[model samples]
Target: MSQEIRGHPQALIDAEKGTLDPLPGSLSHSKDVKPPPSDVLLSSKEKDALVTTTTQEVILSAKPTASSVPKSKRVVSRWTLWNLWFNTYRKFFTFTFGLNMIGLVLAASGHFPYGVKYSGTIVVANFNFAILMRNEVFGRFLYLFVNTCFAKWPPLWFRLGCTSVLQHLGGIHSGCALSGVIWLLFKVVNNFRKLNVTHDAVLVMGVITNLTVMISALSAFPWVRNTHHNVFERHHRFVGWLGLICTWVFVILGDTYDPVTRSWNLSGVDLIHHQDFWFTMGMTIFIALPWFFVREVPIDIELPSPKVAIIRFKRGMQQGLLGRISRSSIMEYHAFGIVSEGRHAKYHYMIAGVQGDFTRGLVQNPPKTIWTRELKFAGVSNTSTLYKRGIRICTGTGIGAALSTCLQSPDWYLIWIGSEQEKTFGPTISRLIHDNIEPERLTLWDSKARGGRPDTMKLLKEAYHYWDAEVVFITSNYIGNSEIMQGCKEAGIPCFGTLWDF
Candidate 1:
């Protein structure tokens, strides 16, 4: 009684100091103390406060250390010197070519005195003008509508109407008058060349003139200069080639000039006598020869090929100016590719739009499995065949269908969510997961997850960071809403999804 009483008093004192250790092997006294009954346990509020306090402690401990440093800036490459050299050489060649052409034009005309006087000035002006016009409003419009109706239509209509009005005014004979006027203008210009215009002098003048005009015109149209860079490049190339050809022709014609009259008289004696002219002509020929003889280098580029492709044809869409009920069809082609050293695979689609009767009403026919078989035949094997090629899939609705043929690919990390209607696809997905697919990689997002809607963007971002996804494949009947597409774009991710309408 004395020892028990003494121990009990010490234990009680130890408990008060929160240092009591229970005795071993007894329900009433053990090394590990049992938790109190539910009624005696801490209240919900107290439990929540304790959890909050613990979380705060953890966060404080995780704070950045004094030695931790901020991230450094990323460096990008710039080929400034190369670009400068390119621009300088390009401008020089372009200027020289233009000047040479104008000289030939002047020499072809017999007006030697006038041609000699203004040829150099005109070349400079023309060269500038050409450069300026490259970025002008009219030039941009022409470029954008090249090979289209816009370029062909308005000009044709205006010229036709003007011609008709002129014909009425001058009667049937007015056509002859118009022709005569044009011929006169041509003869006047040719007279300058006939009067012994120097080919070199004229060429120099023409190039300078073209560049001057081009620069001025382009300067006036700042918006065109800023926006249509591709258009400017094409125009520059075409103009350069045209100038080079014109220069060649001018040199040949200039060499045919008569020595006595100092004009392009085309007498046989003058051609034979002009050795200096021949040398110049040879130089022009040498420059022109390379352009015509150069061949296009062929390049082999591997492009994406679809397996189990799906096509959706939407009819009765309006198009063009005819108020016609235009038919539209969307061809969604899905395929799979292995990425990241066979550790991951991606499913992607190439969506194309087709219009008119040929593609119209095409969605009425049911999607056939023939496409899938064809892909298999064309050196693309299913998941059972090989590990590297990965799988191919296509999805559709109505007459539209989705097809997927697997290859020996790693299991994809798919966060699949669906309602009751999607039960039909459950078996197919299950089969995919069971066979060659990894369970941890698959995320099934059913209605039960977080009252539905489940912060898809947050989930996708997390997945992207954790899994390092290369491609995103989303299949849902809700293609009408554009939010999914918008989100994907915002995330800088490409999406493979079905399209019901154009």
Candidate 2:
């Protein structure tokens, strides 16, 4: 998705028709996008000219840059550790997988110290580790603490480097999950080797869980999630829950009620009895806690146009609010950024940008009741606490993600780029922004008015210096987020953006 598909289809309309309020009246058009003819301006002409999608030579040469140097060669030559990590996500997963493989190799070869006799425990431990990493409560505390601390820390670049580590926590989630699966398989094989009595229940549960985990991992593959999102969501939700249930049965059976004895054991009820059981219980609680908050609440949706749906509802306290709205709570869940007036606000809003069948359905036929989780999960911009001052850069409906953080912190600045942003999102959002936000701190870029695609990298470079911004918060498409992040990294400026690696 173009991050803001809500406006993209509408961008081709006449510029004067777009009713963006905050632009300077004396606007001058740059090459593609126009800048406000005010103090907050685009970069110098030379800096603007230097920015291009194609190589430097392509813009200078009469022919394509590929004519002078093949596109493949040009790209490969520009590769660096900094660029590789910041520009793409594959490296993070690959690194995690590689580390897991190496650890397993070392363990099997007698170089690793952890005992093989407790392989089953190791599996449970890894599973617990994965669960903890993905837990919303744990994630909130961990991210907020680190971000707040880094915010106060004097070493700007060092704290930024530390903050960057936060983005890759998903690595631990992936590595531990994969490792748990492998350890689980080994555990199953060992169980089979020692089996003499009827372990039909244990074997069945083990096999089911193993297959479930493998399928869950495969379904989470980036390509699968992007291409067949519905399938990905179904498998992850249904298969994941099934895997946990089977795991519960397997762990209880394997640890307490041995098939050899086939007798009820009182020790199974002991809270402190076995480490595996406790870990399993912990994982189970982590899985169940969110469902406790799941309720189908009444929704008030405003479909301003065919492209966007402004969903309003009175949720619980808006603190750290981020929700998933789905037609069916169990079938497909999509995360949306929560926008409220403030912490004391009685209600919040969720902007559903038309991206898929579910979102399209939401716009075409608004639902009376939508599923939502009570506990507000953490978002990328939740780390805004880490910066002394920052700029929230967003595109399209992406403004939803950054809007709350900026409102909550007056020190922050917001620059939103979209085509007909004000009209497409409707008056409620515009009224909220106008009433609360000072005109000086907000910049609304109407792309239809401004010629075409925006050079956000240059815009970010200028904003960082102009606003005396210590950090930048970006909530846009992967490309926009990555490009701005990459620009920040290259300039030695601390920045945070959503990797969406999950």
- CA RMSD of each candidate after superposition: 29.5, 9.4
Q: Which predicted model would earn the best lDDT?
A: 2
TM match of model 1 to true structure = 0.24
Compared with the true structure, the alpha-carbon lDDT of candidate 2 equals 0.62
TM-score of predicted structure 2: 0.78
Pairs in clash, predicted candidate 2: none
Off by over 4 Å in 1: 1-408, 426-429, 448-451, 475-481, 493-502
Q: Which ten residues in a row have the lowest lDDT in candidate 1?
A: 317-326
The per-residue C-alpha lDDT of model 2 at residue 183 equals: 81
Query: Which lDDT tens digits does candidate 2 get at residues 82-163?
Result: 5646432335546755776776677667786563556767777777777776676776688777866667555777766555
